[model samples]
Target chain A: MSEELKALDVAVEVDARGTACPGPLLEAKRAIADCPDGGVMCILSSDEGTIIDVQRWSKKMKHEYLGDYEDDGYWRVFMKKTA
Target chain B: MSEEKPNLEEMIKQLTARVDELEENAPGDNLSLGVISGDLDYTIATFIIALGAAAYDMQVDLFFTFWAIASLRDPKKKVKKDFLGKMFGAMLPASSKKLPLSKMQMMGMGPPMIRSVMKMHKAKSLEELMKEAAEFGVRIHVCTMSMDVMGIKKEELIDYPHMDFVGVGSFVDMFQNSKQCWFM
Candidate 1:
């Protein structure tokens, strides 16, 4: 929420809008995997099933899922990196 | 400090040489992953890609977008053709819906009928298969924007372990770091 907090953390953003099913989510996972410890990756999507799929994915990966958000007709998913 | 060690320097050199040998033979860390992004044009493609990646022991992620997101929908949707046609085409509607996607190998009736047969045989449904794949560590994602366009609700989706929702910009960032990216 605060810039200071953000400064102390690394973040990666993945844009998966209209990309297609599975393709985008798979990309997001690979991104999160490459991130350094204590980093977070955010994914943007336009798929309806993501609400369930991405949440389940983050859970399995043992990453922190910050829920989903809508931004100018796009979805924003924030994932915190862990190992 | 031993009173007198027998060839302490020689022993140290031998140990160091062995350590160096082990380090040289040890594998290094290099994790590579591939990503796919497409709609229905990607259903079969995504599955094949996942199977291959899983075989190679590479971590895979399938992010569903738009029509493709429906790929993760209820396997019941698999037999969809509306009430008019599907009713006549199906014997046991519920089982027909649970057939395996890959087993539906009919020429015109190939994929559909194979699914029907798989359903009759009590094969694992798409959701079940995807769940098992996730247990193997596959990550499946869906898009929220498509949800709005399709007028679908999240609660309608199945609860699976390898699923998630994200944004486009986020995917772009993912692309920057991925070893490989596929349009399927």
Candidate 2:
């Protein structure tokens, strides 16, 4: 799943590293608007909660949660805007 | 041909189904918040939950009452007042920036320490969160009774989009319409 996500073409990248709880989520929510419909977006966050927050937020917003991977003490969470 | 009378049983069943569908779809799209604390941490938590719920596209109504109204006071705006009003104004925090933490105050050191850490961690400050909340269309309702008791005038409040001075009954109306009601 991680490799598949890594290989997926992304339309937007939001870097929210070093932010506290909910900060990265807010940033991802704000940045998702820039991603074209059905396009994949990535959020890089150092906050551990961002992984689950992005997933839950995606579920609530009806977006598709692709997957997430850890790199250099940070997480890269991916989602696709689905109308 | 004579028109047949509508079947009472069938009509009742259809009406029941329609009401069920409407009830299912109507109640869960809004959240009502009762903010009664003036502490910085509580205020921040209130906004965090509010903004998060708003992100889900839920309608959010934050009713600020009692001490919470103190945080909404605008420092730059001054109003002439009676003795009691001036005393209340002088004693209360000037704005969101001046609020103290509820715990671990450590002789007035906690607020600044937490604010600095929040900045270092790239978290939104209270002012910034309030701004975002405004942008997200969150409704801010101030309790008129609390305002009157606190001697806070409408002119002294911050200028925010979608803000209103309302009574507790109005807040109860919002609460009744919301899927969840939070008291802070």
Each candidate's TM vs. the true structure?
Answer: 0.43, 0.64
TM-score of chain B of each: 0.52, 0.91
DockQ of each model vs. true complex: 0.19, 0.01
Listed for every candidate in order, the interface RMSD values in angstroms are 7.6, 14.8
Clash-forming residue pairs, model 2: none
Candidate 2 local Cα displacement, residue B106, angstroms: 1.3
CAPRI classification of candidate 2: incorrect
Looking at candidate 1 chain B, the ten consecutive residues that score lowest on lDDT are B29-38
Give the C-alpha miss distance for residue A68 in model 1, angstroms: 9.5
Candidate 2, residue B159: lDDT: 91
- lDDT for residue B130 in candidate 1, whole number 0-100: 59
Q: Give the per-residue lDDT of model 2 (tens digit) for A1-83.
A: 88998899999999988665456777887898899999999999875546655665676578999999999988899999999
